[model samples]
Target: MLKRAFLPPADALVAFEAAARHESFTRAAEELHLTQGAVSKQIRHLEQRLGVALFSRVRQRVLLTDAGRLYLHEVRGALDHLHDATRQVMSFAGSQDVLNLAVLPTFGTRWLAPRLADFLRQTPQAALNISIRLRPFDFELEPFDGAIHHGDPIWAGGIVEPLFPEETIVVCSRPFRDRHLLAGPADLLRVPRLQLATRPMAWRDWFEAKGLVTDTAFQGPRFEQFGMIAEAAAHHLGVAIMPVFFVEDELASGRLVKLFDGTVEERSAYHFVYPENRALRPVVSAFRRWLTAEARSARLSRESLLPG
Candidate 1:
């Protein structure tokens, strides 16, 4: 067990953080609305508590020692977390529970945001705070109650509920398609191919699904987000392999055209993930139920659209 005695005072931590950030006790004191001597005293006390020299006093200037630099990184994170917790508690209203969620950027904008009105309608007492997180993070460190996770169900210390599988298809601007005279999957090889940085093997997988192989399957300008790839493809930059759900607007508006009839199923699917201890929370349970039903409906709708 960690000893409370090992912990420095919160005020001291704040003083240390401000001083380290500005490299000036006077600046830190000004920010904290305290005297320079008081800020210096707090830093000295903190250094004594931790048994380390945090800063070196130079002629009319202060510089962080090696230990101070390392401690600053951890201190900032702790202070930010404390601030978030304090804000959350202060914002609590009668009979209303706050649910913090992290979601992938493109997925959150296209899929989740559109359906959130329904969730809010169903749970009038629930308040949502959503943030974007592209990859998996520790639930303990982050303030989120749950996250919309893609790729796999491998979040440690969290319960993973399957949502829906991703179906990817090749798309390009209608003009590009007509200009290139694309008739089959093989014709895509002659044109520029845009790649998703996160899914480096997307194009390679698409070709493999069609029983084709090529050395240049991985070539193209790479983008970090699906939205970027879609935009680039829509402007006739290059052909892109996009998730069908994400490009529905583009396809419907004829901004981008599907190159073929078939869709490639990615190896991983989306999932609703939360810490195991939160499983019984009413807000969590309600959200999981709503999200599961929405995913099921979407799946059925998608399946109905597929040609037999």
Candidate 2:
């Protein structure tokens, strides 16, 4: 007969449960809003604590060995019980189970909007409401379960969870393309530059990167929302500086095209940010879990496209 097993830390237990259920560390990482290394580390700790190998590592994936499967049966029951007990207490304490979402306009439209259907399907019991706001770290002064913002999580006194990283690129419409002969980033000088009101430093950085200096980077219509900027570019107003990932559908649909691919600048990472006390709520936890998974899926999908 097996001896009673030691209880691992709650977080490691949660990660192990997710990984086991999905049978994929990468998937579990996404769902848990953790790095793959973090998830693996959690499982490692759990395995060491229990003195048994739970996962059989095959070439590119993990499979549940007998030990893993048996442990899962027990861990899963505990997780379900914990989840149930938490939910019962929450329900007894409150009636509104709504999830408030704060989003940047551009990303909301181009990236998250497309994937909204999936989330709604999965979490239909919860109300999903979104508020559009400017980026650069503002989680307070608004009622939201969570917000998606660009740039580094440099804000003080807030909790931030990584969703994914984004790179900005230069793009234009076909009409705006011929307005100037383009050979490189320097060619942007002759084109009308669309700007994000928040990132005034973008033009300076782009020029500095190319060893070129032109005042034209600062000489375009400034807009706050990426949706507006994209619209302006689509109408041949000017070349828009935006995230390539955000505009994937538009690019594929011929609404936009890259003027050049040379400078893929790491502008900011997408982070799910909320108030410092956000971890205390289960709705926030669910949102974090779901967002983490989405980011992971995107990363894997991108990786699969590379020439390996």
Q: Enumerate residue pairs that collide in model 1.
A: none
**Cα lDDT tens digits for candidate 1, 205-231:** 788878888999999999999999999
Off by over 4 Å in 2: 1-96, 135-141, 302-308
Per-prediction TM-score, please? Answer: 0.82, 0.62
Highest lDDT among the candidates is held by which one?
Answer: 1
lDDT of each: 0.90, 0.77
- lDDT (C-alpha) at residue 39 in model 2: 97
TM-score of 1: 0.82
